[model samples]
Target chain A: MNIEQINIKKSIQIYDELTKGRIINRHIYSSSTHSLIDNPLFQELRENLDIYTNQYQMSGHELIDDGEYFYLIYKKLESSTNQLIKTKVYSAIIVLVRCVTHLQARLYESIKNVNYGIEIKEINEIELPEEYLLILEKAKLGTLDKAVEYLADRSFLIKTNRDKYVLSNAGLSIVDEIVERQNG
Target chain B: MINYKSTIKYIVDYDEPFASLVEYMDQHSVTRVPVVFFELQVKQLIDKITKGTDRQIIDAISKAYALRNLKQHNFVTHDESNESIALTKFIEMFVRNMSEKMRVKPITDKRFKAHASQLTNILNEANSYVSKTTNDKANFREYLQDFLSEVKQDFESNKRAITLRTDNLSKLLKSSEAHGDQRLIYTKIVELCERYVEPFFQFISHTQDKNGFIPTMVRLREFFAEQEMLDEEAEVGRFILNFSSYTKDIQHVYDRINDYRRKGQQDLIVFNGFEKAFNHLSEIVMGMQDGLLVRNDLHNNQDFIESYKRFDNIKADNEKHGNVSINYTDLIEHFKNIEKDLVFSSRRSSQNSPLTQEINLERLALDKESASLLRARNQKNKQLILKISKLIKLHFSSFTKLEEPMDIIGDIHKILSAHMDDYRPFFTLYAYTNIRKKLLAIEKQGRIRVCVGYDQRKTFAYNGISYKYRPILIQDLT
Candidate 1:
């Protein structure tokens, strides 16, 4: 597909946001940004995903469209980037595991359903094991607030309220990988 | 004659004390309270009203005794012990009716069958008097009326008992307190299912058996309808109307029980799934901690640095291939490396960088030794898997010859015990998954049948980690 077939300006805006390491999920962002999933540019990108993939590939990033969200990963992982990724993965695992064991939530339901959005207070109230705390501290997600902030910044979690969060599709994708690994 | 008005007034004026006493008796399932205890409680209340002297306490006690003796009040009676105050039937029933606590009185199967037999006897006696004189007909009507009233009371009590029990069970299952103690929750669920739910279902199931509660009720309704048709009496019509209402109430109760059963089954599934996830996560975390401890003991800072150097070399080699996509396994490896860096870096000064750190000869030698030990462990795991797989294959062949369904875990455990000294459930699960995969492939052809018994779960523990899986049955068709 020709890149010019799509709206050049809107496509560039999406590319610019992806390059900044922000995942564009189906959920609407703040007043400054629109939900890409609902945008016409997203429809065009879906139609011409290869075009966008090649576009991002030129900038040392791989565009990943996980059905409900779009994100980019570094092709050649730098040490700092690898460290960031590790921290995110660890924090996600910690949060999700606590959500299941502490709150009695199903793994998929907690991730997929909005009604099952986790309350920050409830997650904070769960007394994690010493080992888990140590890992979370190492990851700089020692507090639930900091973890929420970090994850929200990356669009892994969408804040439904001041104290509630639902997993974005990007977050679910990471958990899906973990679950697949666990099953294997 | 005792003054009924003043006696009621006294009881009402001391309602708090009376209510407390009644509640205590109800909870303890006792009809009597010690006179000393009752006086002590009343004395406390009297003291609260005024700084009561001994004389005032005695006067209060005298008033209580007078009220107990009043035939109109019928609140309490003196037991043979005379040291205790026994509650009269009136007050006992009154307090029970007013109290919020619904104590579920479970009706045993024997009791239920007895009730059914009594109903059948009443039906036969009523039938025998149908053609007799006016007096006999009147006796028949009276008998039927008494039976109807008794059955109605029984139905109400049964409905309340089952409803309250189910609600309590549901609350317990959902309660956070019960979530922590899964064994307790499981026990309660089993109790609810066996002691209450299963029996209630059996009693109500009209289709499965002709002698169930519903069928018996249907027969009673038919008798009442037949009598109403033959006699053309308003009383018989009332009986028919009453039975119809009872049917509606029974339907409501049945719907509630059905809903509760469905929710209970769902709760069980969710509970099991969460338990499995929790166990799996716990196992992984424990394994990670164990691995970290072992590595920490075996490898020093310099060994870690050398390993990182090797890792960097591998990374560089991968980079040469142009744009490598990282998977979960690679991400986990990277995370482990980061963890190691954090562990060792803390011991060193916060300011000192990895590049500036000097490598010692002894630590370099330890790194190579650690590398060789990891390789040996991997090799041992592989050998164990191969041995387990072979034993499983041998067992499956024997089972095929015998034409019997295999108890996968049980039979495999026996085979492993007879053949190998070293056995782990983890290795067995790995081998089982492999065998299952192979059988599934072969099952695609019309040569064999593979069935996973989801209802039957087999569990085994190794090194304090529990593994649960469904049994798989394979049958050779050709």
Candidate 2:
């Protein structure tokens, strides 16, 4: 199976198992026993929820303890027809990011130019500009066209054809110039 | 007018046969020829070969020859792989015959297929991994490198335009620096600790060390402080204290009023300060009820227990007078009414009050600061309370990860007792029974188990089986 398919399955599993599966009894959670929410394990789980919710087209019950940390249980929006279509779209992004990153790595090696390939791990850490991240977080893989559209506006990359993209000359030049300046 | 070149250096491994085929196609004046060495999309091959070919001659060749081939033979006639070789050979034989014409180039079919497959895998693998691992930063970096490659080859090179503007370059550096900053890491960890750790445990010890107020009182002070109603806090405290005192003082005045009524005496303690004091206590009690409800949404057993104890304590002191002239039940009824009236009401309106208004403003100011010792102590208490409560709850569950069970049993019991609230009797009872049973079971089986129980201490049967009880420690579990 494809990488996108794997992610979709994993996502669905996480959604079904750890998060959506647990029944939240307010009476139990609100009681003295609810102190479980404060555990580091639960806190980590809650942070994971925040990250996922921000990246995918999903929502859940988020309990914030006075803005310090949060507890969230995400439920996939089963009613959204757009979400069903987005499954494929989300899969596409994984495919595209994978492909481009690989291609970039090869090109960088051949040219001995550090500016060529994408820093995939760094990209994940590098908080996307708020406007772009918001779009990406809410986007389904199927609406990758929309993702590309957002990227284009920011001059990150542009789609040359269906399922194909290349860094715009403008974007490429930026990295090239940065490297040149750095080397000097 | 655009010149495009296929990167066909790798195709020479299968070059000889392709050259022969092209010679034949060129001799036949075939255009739009197909290369069928691979059973793939031949159209892309045809487009690749004829990218810069002469339009007029190619157009005529396509109309006359391609159409005729299609009509006459159905052997995938006019297929680009077959005719393209013929066209190439024809061009080589008589180079002068087609001057200023668009020339077509044949790209080896095997080469195209090989590149396409590799590209597909590269794309697909990156796609799959991004979704599975959220925490694996390394994979994300790898995928990004791949993404850049696909983009680099696919676009036209423009040396001048690709250069980064100074601002964007600065942003890139700034962002990279931010990514590596230890402060960001510290902030995140602190945020995690606050969100996850501070809420559960009550740091009452710290409060005693730092400020004299108890955890609950600190919370109350904060609430009043936020309202800019500090004046009300002192008044409220005094008011509550006075009510407790009056519950005692009222007894004497009430008796005087009663005796006077019996004898029909005129000058009684009923007329002035005594009556005002009694009424004032009732008003304060009502105000407190409103304030408490606004601070928390709690309406369960703990709340009930707090109110019940306070009211009974006050009433018992008042009843020391044998006369019991005042109706204590009426005061209780008044307090209960205040709770019922404000049950679900939003406390936003309280912000408008002179008492809350300035306090809210000050809180807003405080929120901008990095950290507060007062807040820290408050959070410590919350964390301690939550930790104790969790330990008591977890005591009933079976220990799964522990290597030694005996030690855990003891540690859990200690945690339970330390944060124990008098109101949650069942929690303590259940915890005690479960811990006892697990210890006994550990000794009997030569193994340890942490068992959940619903208190039937006499039968000692938890989850339908009886077990011996003993204490477990933290080391035993870990």
Candidate 3:
């Protein structure tokens, strides 16, 4: 293949990553994964993803530039076969994030500006719904551990320590999307 | 028998008019009918619902019964007419309670009786203030200061008592599942609820002069009774809401006290921010008596009062992002609600200072840790699909049927399903289309010659059984 052809291939590879619900933070991914932060090929994809893929009919998936990271938001359709998240797991995650935020804001101890990474011990202090009992039991790493890990695995949260995870921008965006769905 | 809230909800659910055609119905109910008798009733319910109920309930009921369907419909339904009749029948009961022998049923839940009586006592004391007939009219500012001091004293004394009781009650609620003590949990819930719910009467009783405080007190009463109707299982949500609501009040009291002690302007800027929102709401609601009801989402969402409970006494411009970020939609809504204060309910400042504008909004930023996590997930998901696609290719390579397309993918699906047991995220049954879509795109680009075709067919086993499936074939796209 010619150099231009190879660049086009690289762009598709980048598109594939986003299509799977993964976020491409240019600053990090350029260094860690592709080393293509300023590379013409990756930059081309970053700048013009929708233009090339507009013909492919991406099942209502759109490339969203939330200004922090790049990812695909699947506009959820009732009959569309893309079933990525379970409702119970989603609810548990939202509840966990709320608990962490509520505790940090309310408790505000001697330490200031500590990352809102919640330990299972701290997570246990907040009240959650009864239906969550089943979800916790289904979690392989015990309820709280599995709960955080599931979000981390989905790129919704990032594991900071053995006991704590921080919600990612992607996670917050997903939650924002969930709330919009709920509102509509 | 008299759930005043339920009756009002019944009318508003149906009667609130939509766009234009039947818009007169919104006014006609109060102007033309006996429904005006319950004008005070509807106003109280609208307050309780928007400001007092859980966000989940508010969101659910509002969306399910939004004002869209009432465009051409009459304001009152047959059921509401029935409810209106029932409401009139109960006027004597509401009045009789004001006098000695109201003749209501004694609460069967013994847990609530103590707190209920305490509420009655506070009500009696505050009610006497209205009848005091002072020679000189009490200054509103002086009156509020005195009431605050009393409330602060009351809170300080009961802080530990309420904490200890609620702590024990929540523990009982958690353990009730394993211990099978449903009744025990129920009573504890009632007791915990009563401890938090009754103090509002003290505010409502004396704060008749304080703008918007009495209406809030009325909503708290309805919210408390609403809590009473919930079973032990469902009451957990209400239980958390009660604690949140109380803590919000305590936080406000603390902030106001701090402001008063600071002895600066003590302009009651933040306090009156809330006061004005409430004052404005009361004016709009009171206007409903004139049969001029211009409906909108009411002001002073109680959630906002609770949210900035600490910052409420300070200048609005100084409001800042403290420590953590709330990711949910409600947080966004809470910030938007900063507009409802009606104190600085002015045009948005070009600078958008937290103080001068409605919401001191911050754009959520992705941290390095989160960014790295997302990048790693992308690489991993890519690798997963690549490996699964190879396995699928190898399975399809043993294609013996060159005569026509064969139903080979179904058996491949069963094999992939078992092989991808640990691959929960990647290998979903629903993603058969996703996998196929990717494979076809690759084929169209000539990167791979993998073939996928589809057909719905009635199937027959070689021996006896027959079934149907959305059958498909796989081969090299040669």
TM-score of each: 0.41, 0.17, 0.23
Docking class of 1: incorrect
Tell me the spans in candidate 2 whose CA falls farther than 4 Å from its real position: A1-104, A108-150, A182-184, B1-478
**Fnat scores for every prediction:** 0.00, 0.00, 0.00
lDDT of 1 by residue, B213-276 (tens): 5455556656767766444244434544565454555566556556655544444544454344
- Determine which window of 10 residues in candidate 3 chain B has minimal summed lDDT: B309-318
Clashing pairs in 3: B316-B355, B317-B355
Residue B151's lDDT within candidate 2 is: 30
Better candidate by lDDT, 2 or 3? 3
- For model 3, residues A56-99, the per-residue Cα lDDT tens digits are 23544455565545555444332322122332234445445433
Candidate 1 lDDT, A98-183, residue by residue in tens: 55545553433443455556676776677665655544544445565567666766667777633466667666555554444434
Residue range B368-449, candidate 2, lDDT tens digits? 5636767787897777556655775566465445654334433544455455554232444555554565566654664444
Where does the lowest 10-residue lDDT sum fall in candidate 1 chain B?
Answer: B308-317
Better of 2 and 3 by TM-score: 3
Give the per-residue lDDT of model 3 (tens digit) for B220-307: 3444354352332233234334444555654454343333223211111222232333333334334333543332211222322232
Alpha carbon deviation, residue A103, candidate 1 (Å): 11
TM-score per model (chain B): 0.40, 0.13, 0.17
